[model samples]
Target: MTYPQDPYGQQQPYGQQPPYGQPYQQPGYGQPGYGYGPAMPPQDQGLAIAALVVSIASLVVCTGLLSVIGVIMGHIAHSKAKRGEAGGQGMALAAIIIGYIGVAIIVGLVLVFVIVGIATDWDFD
Candidate 1:
């Protein structure tokens, strides 16, 4: 800490490198940091989101087909998220629940129809 000290190290000869080597080193070049290892991959959320969308659509479209698709997509999303390859776990769960609900609704309607038809039989002799 002297008054006439040099920050860049003792003055180098004309057109010479400063002491201590290159002033800075690029990262990932074994320079301490700079993504020395595989970069963190972006999470794939398509499955999770698709599951949610299909589940919602099931209520309006083919309750059986769409709901089945939603359930599959949700399972895939959950698997990917578990492997640290995707996001939106909550969305996947919601999709699964909704898909099941859709399936249940369809089943309930069929049962109701059968019950009413049986109850009102004319018993034509």
Candidate 2:
């Protein structure tokens, strides 16, 4: 007995092509893959805002030393965040602002104290 040569002869109706492409021609990679992958959210915005608030507050409260320290930290944080290294931008900015405020307050207070002391007369030999 002779066998039919067409492999798909029995499975498919005579004229139909394959449903998909050839096996070797993969339809992935480089082609738009499946769904959207993981992505990074916007960070550091909060940190920067926090830093600004703290720095301003520190200045008003007359904590010059603390404010200055905060200012430094804020700047560092901001730099890092900008570079996409780490978060805490707000904290860093706050520190810098606070530091400057503290310094100003301290200076002003010192001047007032000195002028008052000089103007007043106290007899102590």
Candidate 3:
């Protein structure tokens, strides 16, 4: 099969190449002896994403349970980052902090309610 450059002036045939003054271009890995090598595989980000999302949602939704989950996931993600298993250390830390704040808010509200109830002599019975 003849691989002729259709219509266009550039003739990129099978064995033939561009005329002089044109630099030879390799597919992806350039140069000889040294190759670009395979692209780095993406690091696992499940824990990191979960931590951040859960923390943010908890903070906005004011849900203590999700905040706790966020804190747990954050710690796991941070550990993974330390061991070079994953990334997003900053994200994990932020999630942990946010989670703590959410938990604190929840506890604070509970305490406030309890104090108000006792002051008013509210009876559960």
Candidate 4:
């Protein structure tokens, strides 16, 4: 029987193994080729969230030191989350919200204090 020639002219018989000691390689088999594997779970998620929360809260307390720390923590958390290191989305978001609220309160208080001071002191020279 005349076998049909393959594209490479390599006559591969059906259900027959490759030549012995020829390093047989199957198409799309056990090779480390393309496609990704299962996604690994994140680590240190809780820590990141905690940091974010602390930082945000500090802002409201009028403690720049705490706020700075919080900001730094939040940034770290965000980076980890982005890189799939830790699942800290909720914590990071809470931290951000709290921080904003704290800042707003501080600003408002300062504004009120300033306004009150200016109003009470009316010395026209």
Measured over all alpha carbons after superposition, the RMSD of each candidate to the real structure, in angstroms, is: 7.2, 10.7, 7.9, 8.0
Give the winner by lDDT: 3 or 4: 3
- What Cα-based lDDT does every candidate model obtain? 0.79, 0.64, 0.83, 0.66
Q: Residue 76 CA error for candidate 2 (Å)?
A: 2.1
Flag clash pairs in model 3: none
User: How close is every model to the real structure, measured as TM-score?
Assistant: 0.63, 0.50, 0.66, 0.53
Clashes of each: 0, 17, 0, 2
**Ranking of all predicted structures according to lDDT, beginning with the best and ending with the worst:** 3, 1, 4, 2
Sort by TM-score, best first: what order?
Answer: 3, 1, 4, 2
Writing each residue's lDDT as its tens digit, candidate 3 over 1-125 gives 22233455444544566456665554343366644678787888888888999999998999999999999999999999889999888888988999999999999999999999999999889
Model 2 CA deviation exceeding 4 Å by range? 1-35, 41-54, 88-91, 121-125
* Residue 43 CA displacement from its true place in model 3, Å: 1.9
Top candidate by TM-score: 3
Candidate 1 stretches greater than 4 Å from native:
1-39, 122-125
Worst 10 residues of 4 by lDDT: 1-10
Against the hidden true structure, what lDDT does model 3 obtain?
Answer: 0.83
